[model samples]
Target: GESVGLHLPTLSVQEGDNSIINCAYSNSASDYFIWYKQESGKGPQFIIDIRSNMDKRQGQRVTVLLNKTVKHLSLQIAATQPGDSAVYFCAETRGAGNMLTFGGGTRLMVKP
Candidate 1:
């Protein structure tokens, strides 16, 4: 995304490697975690999700780690590419509706 209200702008990353983005949540009741990727000027697409009961989840070249102990979360991307470049956001939901609480968001710059 094009940066939050007044927080830090973004971080730059190179292609063909891994990238990790961090996020923190306020609610302790949150039990579900999801990661989303948003290309420029588009809605965020679901990436992967993990339940509070689980600590780790993996997907195609991607991994989501949840730390309920600290109310922290992270997303990891492997062999990143230009197509993989975008703004990534982490979300947490308490229950139904799949409602998501987004983080500060970060832009992934894949060097060609």
Candidate 2:
């Protein structure tokens, strides 16, 4: 219902630098937030996750910050690389196994 009015697109980013991935969520009641990285022709691999109660969470070379005040979320990647190049996705779940809703998506590119 809420996703029916959302945008489904992909964003491209350059490599060997920092990347900020953004996602717009339609529901304001969501709680659990998970970020995933997917390479071509493969399933998503979990990168990091954060709870609605928390403002920020970090992982290996990646950080996920949630702004409940603005109802927005972001994933920051440090020192992106060609090997790190892949599509990033944000998945929101209200509770355990609550049918995760995915955002548009993001593509990261690395240049030598």
Candidate 3:
């Protein structure tokens, strides 16, 4: 079965440096991708998202990129801060929009 998974389970970065998180999905039919940030004891929050039609999308301090040909997705955080530390996940779903397959998640740690 096709599923989404992260290339790395953990990512460490400096408080003021940039961070990149990678994800791969096996389902080629998925048309939408979303990046979520989950803090301890809290639900995942939407950070950014990109449609399969677009190659890249940017929001505030975050960017999302999609490569359909390679079934790859990436999240880039600029000037990462302590508050930005969390578990990030990538989710994908078909056009139905009723179901979302999530990745294993990657833990982001920021060091001051």
Weakest lDDT window of 10 consecutive positions for candidate 2: 3-12
lDDT tens digits, residues 1-112, model 2?
A: 6541113345455666887888777788898888889999999999999999999988888999998886788888888777777888888887566878887677766675
TM-score pick, better of 1 and 3: 3
Against the reference, the lDDT scores of all candidates come to: 0.79, 0.79, 0.94
lDDT of 2 at 19: 76
Per-residue lDDT of candidate 1, residues 33-64 (tens digit): 78889998999999999998999999999999
In angstroms, the error of model 3 at 84 is: 0.6
In candidate 1, which residue ranges exceed 4 Å CA deviation?
1-9
How far residue 11's Cα lies from its native spot in candidate 1, in Å, is 2.1
lDDT of 2 at 75: 86
Ranking by TM-score: 3, 1, 2
TM-scores for every candidate against the unseen true structure: 0.86, 0.86, 0.97
For 1-112, candidate 3 gives per-residue lDDT tens digits of 9999999999999999999999999999898999999999999998898988999999999999899999999999999999999999999977665488899999999999
* Residue 57 Cα positional deviation in candidate 2, in Å, after optimal superposition: 0.6
Of models 2 and 3, which has the larger lDDT?
3
Question: Which regions in candidate 2 have their CA more than 4 angstroms from the true location?
Answer: 4-14
